[model samples]
Target: MAAAIMNLVRVSDPDTIVLGGGVAGSANFVERIRSYLNPKTMRFVSSARS
Candidate 1:
């Protein structure tokens, strides 16, 4: 999954990424994602405040 995303980022060079919907419901899903993608880009999303 991370490898696929990394490939996309490398090809696209986007400025920002957004993670929304059900996957964002997981507690550490965003963090795990950020850890894999940084310090390459920034993410914009809401956290699970529960």
Candidate 2:
């Protein structure tokens, strides 16, 4: 899931990413995704939890 999100980020270069649905309700899950993201790549991207 994190890999997929990263891929989308690479393609879309969005400033923000909003997560929803069942899995997103898990704070751990959200954190895990955030963990996988590269700081360099996400320099301009907003938090997924924002």
Best by TM-score: 2
Model 2 scores a C-alpha lDDT of 0.77
Q: Write the per-residue lDDT of candidate 1 for residues 1-50, one digit (tens) a residue.
A: 55666677678876655556898767688667656754534242232233
The alpha-carbon deviation from the true structure for residue 10 of candidate 1, after best TM-score superposition, in angstroms, is: 0.3
lDDT of the structure predicted as candidate 1: 0.58
lDDT of all the models against the reference? 0.58, 0.77
Clashing pairs in 2: none
Candidate 2 residue-wise lDDT, 1-45, digit = tens: 877877888898877677889988898988888898888876766
Maximum-lDDT candidate? 2
Candidate 2 local lDDT, residue 3: 79
TM-score of 1: 0.52
